[model samples]
Target: MTARKKGPPTGGSGANAGAPDTLEGLFPRFPGTKDIRYHPVFQGGLSRWVWRYYTHRLTRAGRWFLGLTCLLGLVGSTSLEIQTYIPFLYAFAFWTVAGAAAAFSRPRVAFVARHADRVCAGETLPVEIEIEQRGRLGGADLNVLPSGLPIPVDAIPEGGVPVPPLRRGEKARVRLGLLCRRRGVYVLRGYRVETDFPLGLLNAYRVFGEERSLLVYPPFHRLARMEMPTGRRFHAGGVALASLLGDSFEFLGNREYREGDNVRDIDWRATARLDTPILREYREEFFLRVAVVLDTHVPRGGRRDEREARRAALERAISVCAGITDYIARQEYIVDLFAAGPNLYHLTAGRSLAYLDQILDILACVEENPDEPFAVIEPQIDERLAQINSVVCVFLDWDETRRAFVENLRRGGAGVKVVLVRDAPPTLDPSGDERAGAIPVIGRADFERGVEEL
Candidate 1:
């Protein structure tokens, strides 16, 4: 089972493809769906009746018969043989009338395209196309031919999807398993329903317009349990490192009590001496706010293979960001995603799965920008780091540039953990000590292990 290619796989911009924010509009039309712009009728080369007859009347069998008749007539004239010419001409004349009759007697049918509520990249979806009679058309045989959508939509058992002969007003469903090759909200335009009923010698097909659409979410992978580190206690500027109530042992200071302050923090010893209600303030004790910054700028100017490898690496990075975002949000932490390319994608997601959906939605269409680099968004990351306790950066490359980025975050008082994505396997201490600090250059194969250990 295989569905036709999901959409125009060559580019996301399909014909009539609307804005990315709203994937609305009918999809592009293929060859069979193209209306006759200027046929012989329009140019006055042939009458309208003859033009219409030529459109769907000539089948492969009919055309072959006519060609054989002309060949036989030509040979018979050269050899003066009336027997071969007369038989071939009679056969062609019989089929010509049969094809003309078949063209006007197309089976009346209606159709509906059905599939799963949602699909993701690499997942196969079964599109059930139900075909029913529109009128008193009964017990008709149809040779349904399908034009590929942007993606692959394969008919079950190959050949053509066969529809069983149904009683008048009855319906039959044909299943086509379509594999989603990419992620996006795709609009499947139409299917060509061809029929050569009664006789297989003529062609008769109608465009069954099916304006169905499906959304493909970014592919997700389940990872092992992970614990992200909240940085060491630091209090300066408006930024509060850690939570309001971190470890009880790591007390920062004592301040006047306020409403909603935990009663357990009421320091009776300081309250009596100061003659005021004093509450113990602990560092690194608040909601877990993680800054998830993704690097999405594709490296430019390289060999064709190198560029392709780097592009693939960026997609993997996005997938890593998606998995990590879900993981962090699942932990009841507030995840703020920061990535700048064609658009500056920023989302602050809480523990709710809806927020995770929002993040994945944005990541599904996130493409790298060749113009913007990590430097262009460093300022934004710095601003975000000033408010959050921890920063998690997923970068496309790890060089002096990224090392410096890590160092800056370290100085910002926010606990910094970096995930570096590269094409080659990481050469370092399995102890994760070869590179000082918490930057783990994770390989594609060892993503789970590296992230888990981190």
Candidate 2:
């Protein structure tokens, strides 16, 4: 939830007549038709004082000019004494003070904003702001100043009148652009709204209270070229007839419908004479399932640089997972994903894009943790192997431990392929140099080629 701010309710009609002498006195005596709240934000103490001093100097200089002119006239006057010029000097000083006061008297303005702190990495979203005038503003212009951004700048100032006359009881809107670069939670800072109207000398700014952060998930790269073992394909609510001839996993029989037989499936002619409902039996065949494995351990490639490299590796893994999920889902396979690192994330088998999106989000939040070894987590994965027919493993490099695990799965009758992302060399060396067999090893530079090979 965001907090609400109140600003001065009234604004200027055109100029002079109704302008408030000062911000403090501009408070609406009786609340106008619209309610205004004051959200007072003082610029830096030193800065504000400096600005005040600068305005005072300008006023003094105007007064000095008027005094010098009056003195010259008094010296030139032959009939009137110098004392007569005193009244004229006083009037000139008053006008000088009025001019400076009007220039410095800024309207009290408040800015309210709301933002979504977190979005999927690579997605663009809008940030909204509402601004209201406080007192009778002589005139004002509102702008959302640009600042450093992590994501791509989309549309900023979500389309408001480029320049709107902020009148009493009136409000204006503004928006900004944002783009997500990569996965990770980021704190939003330096978002400021400023106004420099009436007098461009001073820029009045206010910070929106909608202080929030964004959590961006990593981009899921497309893995359309992943190697997959062919399996049964079924239409929604339809059973495969070929698998039903003794090879199907389940056996169902024709039965007489009690009360609700699908009208389309009912034997209408038979029912018309005997008034009995009959429906055809469906022999359902289960399709093969594939599990996606992401090795989240701090590998040799990951340890290249302490923090940045590890972060990059995790991002790559998440992106690969997204691509894998998309590719497998397109082929109509039940795809599941499992990650082992500081913590373990397991996504159950599903073909829906929504489910895959959830998996991608999990991948976005994944990070390296110095906990449970890969071998220890292997048993946890083994428990779910019955439902999975094949495994597609995504890892940074190929090593003995990974090879042993792949061999274990292959010997257990599971079709396994290792998709090693060789951005860097493996930390462990090969003992018995066995030429690569079925699984393909891919390098980072050859990612495009790997996609085709897979």
Candidate 3:
């Protein structure tokens, strides 16, 4: 969620200084009505009732009929003519009959839904629901619909999945597609079974209460290659960190068996030839460990358009982070991802210990922070800097705070690389010293065209 600036509202310019304060002035134009929908006043009372009545209770055909009735009634009242009154009375009678039918048409059924636990954003998730008839009457013309989705209603298909006619005590399964446009965790309340059986004018539905959660991972590009300054660090546990046993230890040479050595390490052949008990010696493994720091902070208090632009930049940075993670995973290096949004997120994977999916899960749920995220991330990195071979910072802006953070990491003796996600090309290098190396800026157009390498 975006943080709201806390202060008094600003006044308009000189041309509009004398304008009256009205509803329009309090609520400025925005791309979406999310703020209004969650407002305290709009959450309950008459406003919410009206919204629910129009969206959920009224069907498309019902809306058309009601509109026609109101229009005819107004015309008849103005003209005071009996002929105009006939059309208005007919519309009103039909609307009353549809409402009465819908009131008594609620279906009695039970639904069980099955779907994957996770999916990628911008992909269609197929859900299969088994609907069982629980009433004495046979059911027909039933429509299965998904409820409590995090996306808009338009994301679903025009007509929901159609279920086959069922007899008493019969069951039928239907499949529906849910298109998720954004990445996040969403709880699906249940399915809505409705029908416009006789007149197709009104819709009566029953909402089931089967709750299920799904995680949507952010979609990312496939990088052909990635270059970074890195080195090797000693891992005490080596492969044992992922698995307790197996080929975790490296063979060095045989030595005379010591009294405290385990029997499993004894070399029987060497012991017989030399007439002495011998044991195998091994060394701890050393591997590359890279830290990927994602910048999630976006300054608050901007025009709606500017805020949206910044949000887009943040998403681009997330995708880049995913790409880097994938590239690093392919190289068999240990990955440590650090990000701060509303809270701090840290994960260690790669090198057969964990998969890239774990890191994507973090990226999916990371939000935009209005406060300084570097402050939260610096301490975490400092604690593990000794074990980290290199640091890759993905930033939305090249400001002083971020620059100083990266410089500090480099000064602490860790290899550092910088990536700036921006909507446009940079005018100048933020770091004046050429010896510090150039930062690669990925623009919005470049992401659209597809980023093959970095």
Candidate 4:
């Protein structure tokens, strides 16, 4: 016989020999049946029913009773015993009675709320609400709960802000302290007025719709001193020319009048003394204009933990930028903020022209951009590079893109200061290009503990 043909190994030395063939592998295009229990139609209905039962119909005691009823029903169904069915039926009847009582016990009320337009993060926001009973029946055991705030339940009182029993047409005012966790613009959607009466097996609540907005500014350390590159460029009309149009000039010595010279500049005394037309020469005002370029670009596509770390780094960078702006605001320099997030942001504040609060407002709304932001930011800065004396760049990473951006700024004759915000010590040398100068790396831990000076 011819030499036996070699065959593939059945159980060894083959990639798929020992692997079990799965149905998914055999039919890659298989459209498997979805679990009906988890379908949106079922899930949404179930969740809504559960929420309504818990919030509107069920109380703490009712939940325990319901659980016991469910256990009894399961046992009765399995054993088909009359004795087991009796307890389940009794529990079910009690639940039905409790729910009916709660449904009719809902408090009919109207309310109004007032709060500040803005609050700093990590601070307690006080919301003042005035509730009035509208129904013929008096409202009792009322709880005022603010809705649409990202506040923890533990932060608020267990039963919410309790209001004493109110007679018909009576009103009560209560203050609710909302704990702000992070910085962002938030809207207070409404307030829920809830009460549990009678059997205390359910809570009857009515939601009052009230739309209000609140801005939360990021919390930042107050820097005692911040070292920035020393530079001042000539401002044609100083703060007036930079912001508005007005007179901002310094008087120099007297000189002969020119044809285009303003008649107002003619020095009558000098002209009289010299017996010739002489004019007072003035120079344009000069001041420091620093650009605080905040890097809000967060790379996309990473593990959950990695994405979180990147976000944390971005927040730290924001805090650093806030601190720098705070320090610059105290000085006499004109500060311009350049941040590239979802959109490009540019704000000018300083010399009493604008308040620091405006800068904080911009920072509050800044979001993370996944794409490289330097491309958009470079063009923005280039347009005003001639006016900007120094640039304070707050970057999350010191990668090639950022390095190139900074290098370009230095080439454009801007005094640049780089601040790298990272959780760990930086691995890449930020000073690889001497033209960018030495960069200061600020660790997240140090920032959290507080950096008094930068």
Candidate 5:
């Protein structure tokens, strides 16, 4: 949520800028009528009513009927002056006012409450709205404008029937159905509460705005790389350490000797008394962590081609990171994410499945900036390399500077996996020997195939 800046108070913004003399002076004053009620007003009694009937949507047939009615009405009032028709007009006016008053007496009403601001994808949350009558009145017809989400309804009208009448001050709690099908931010717009009130002759409506936002994280995806080092000890060359018994690591409970069991694993002291030999073991040591770096900026090339290439690259990077995080987490190893975008994002090492959602949320909103260079942030990335066991760099370009940075990371005893977003020519040394001491440079195709293999 963004912070809101406070502005000058309401009273300070107008000509009557001085503080209110009394508490009542501070509040808004409505003119004349003591009752704060709104009623639909119409003009010209029968004439207006007849005009409205004539204008019941100007179709060809409707216009002909309207002309015929006007002609007949004019002929029937031939002896009566427009003034002589006062009594009839008065009666019509009285009936119209009475009808409007009756409708307002039981104005249909609705109130929104218990709204949920957060929900996960594919999850349904119940929204509550209270609808009631305004005064000592009863209303039948009610309708909601700009309908809500398409979720199954839990409760219909109170009775096992539709269109139930509501009494004055009596309320019905409505549970609006809500469903989320995708992840990201969702904004809830205002609801249009409406009702026909006492009669179906006229409809009344009101707009209700209760601003809300929801942040949804992406769903989890499985990691398939089994050979990837997990929570296991590795030498400088990234090889898992062999577990040998009778070593100084620690002494675990002895177990029965099996075929091909190493003699060094045998517990000789236990073997002397018991007929069978037992082996001692220690808990495995683990020293593995992964640092994921996503490069956000894509350089200009062909318009669509560059965009498609950049998009493909970003996807590959996200896929690789997801796989690595899942694989490492499953194996009890820690993983962290570092984004080299206009917005710098860093998540510390964690071993839970929950972090996957967090990482994906950040990835979903990540975009490239033309001015930012992935190389410019190398120093900060280097600073974080001390604790991370491996650095996975996902970038579009691979120049000498980037190559040196990767080489430096490797020299600093950190494993480096460079997933190039674009294809790179075979790496050549300063001496022009393309094959000697060339670091493994996986192109976009290579990375895609690698992920599939994993």
Candidate 6:
């Protein structure tokens, strides 16, 4: 369990001021929110000191300026160098020492922050940084930008975020923005605080925060505008003569009144006629079991680049799995997702608000496994095949083995739908699992359109 972070500090020192207001809270608390992570600190060693303080990444202009300083020093070392050049050497030396000295000072302000890091892919998240310092911040001398970000300009600060004046104790706040590009867990090492006080030539920065993690979940998509087909009842119970055939909720026949039975639902007429307590007996209801299988296996023995590409393709498949789970659960079915990761998992995704959150949390961190075989989940699927009304199969590759697997589900009496994701090429050869056969096969890229056609 994770501690639910409260709304961004109302005082304007936190990220999103409140919880995410998205589509009906369809989002989950991103994958990782447990534990505090530390950022790298300087050790007392010559190499560490020189690397952390004396040197820094030079801005374009800073690079040229430093090169010029070096050239001047070289000329001064020669006795034969002109006297006019000697003035240039002294001027450069003065600026370097002064700029370095001003920026090299440790930050007087202490910072603390709160971030709403959990977000769906492609959504913007807010961040708030609050500053507490014993001395006033002087102008822009104590500049604050989120460090360790590839693009520092993206973190937007909140309005009225005072850049505290120097030498006076004060408080300050800054808000930032984050863009999550993919579905997975990301750890933020910490924000970098840098200052170019006396000269912009050398911007000295220090790492000043603990690490934070963000979990980005797969984006949800509606399969189609049409309604999902509820299956014929595969279990006992329920008055749903039609739904009893196979769907989420079913009505069962009345039974003898029980202590726990809702008093309101008691059948008065039956009680009066029999002169005894009788309750409306309904069958134990269960939803059409939606078995969603995500094939995360990537062929082994490929180069690093090739394997990376395969992983990307598999990620798309995972997104498709998320989409299908969302669609089925929204339709009010019990979605059983059999996905392979570090260990094979069988997740029961339900329509209840709490269960939906749980489902997305696990999916957010699932990784692809190349060593695991696709056949591993087949037996589990077979075990529950009798109850499953429909089978949605998502795969990374296509071969005789997988084709036979889909055929097995169909043969077991479950409605079969195949999603051949981007990684696998279509098999045109005429066979039971081919496009020419009875089973419906759709490419991952065209999943939405395929569902519409279905």
User: Root-mean-square deviation of each candidate, in angstroms?
Assistant: 9.9, 14.2, 7.2, 14.3, 15.0, 9.9
lDDT for each residue of candidate 5 in 1-454, tens digit (9 for 90 to 100): 1112243222111111232223432112311111111112223477444433332212234345445545555654776645544554554564476457544543447565576555444566566766666755566655543222111111122111223577877877655545544443434544445454443333344556554544443333465643422222343322233212211244667888888878897888988879778877655344566766666666666677656666556555555555566566565555667665445556654444235556655554444555545555576667856666777666565556567766787776676666555553423332353311323344666774565433
Worst 10 residues of 1 by lDDT: 21-30
Ranking by TM-score: 3, 4, 6, 1, 2, 5
- Clashes per candidate, residues 3 or more apart or on different chains: 26, 20, 0, 1, 0, 29
**How close is every model to the real structure, measured as TM-score?**
0.66, 0.61, 0.83, 0.77, 0.49, 0.70
lDDT of 3 at 158: 35
**TM match of model 5 to true structure:** 0.49
lDDT of 1 by residue, 1-454 (tens): 1112233333232111222222221122112222232221233435534444443455657667667877877776776545776776787687777767676767678877777746666777777788887756574666564443443232333335778877888888777666665665555656666666656667677777666655566565655665555853343423232323233246899899999999998999999999999999876445567888888767679787876667677766777787888888777676788777666667777645246667766676566777645676677777767667788888776666666777788788777777777765444432354433656566667653444544
Q: List model 4 lDDT by residue over 388-439, tens digit each.
A: 8899999888777888888888887888898888875454677675766778
> Which of candidates 5 and 6 is the stronger one according to lDDT?
6
Task: Encode model 6's per-residue lDDT on 1-454: one tens digit a residue.
Answer: 2212332221111111122233321212111111111112223366443443333434345667767877876776675546646766676886668576655554666778788767776676777877666534443455555544321112444111335455445667776666655665555556655555556666655567576766667666656542333366545542223332243334566667878878876888988999988777555555576778888776678687767667766766776677778777777676778876645667765545235556666566666675655667888888878878888877676677777887788888787776666634544333353431443344545654444433
Q: Please state the error at residue 6 of candidate 3 in Å.
A: 21
Q: Say which candidate scores most in TM-score.
A: 3
Which candidate would rank higher by TM-score, 1 or 2?
Answer: 1
Q: Considering TM-score, which of the candidate structures 5 and 6 is the better prediction for this target?
A: 6
Candidate 4 deviant stretches above 4 angstroms: 1-45, 74-90, 148-155, 238-284, 302-304, 425-427, 431-433
Top-scoring candidate (lDDT): 3
Candidate 1 vs candidate 5: which has greater lDDT?
1
Ranking 1 against 5 by TM-score, winner:
1
Error of 5 at 181 (Å): 7.8
Superposition error at 348 for model 3 (Å): 1.9
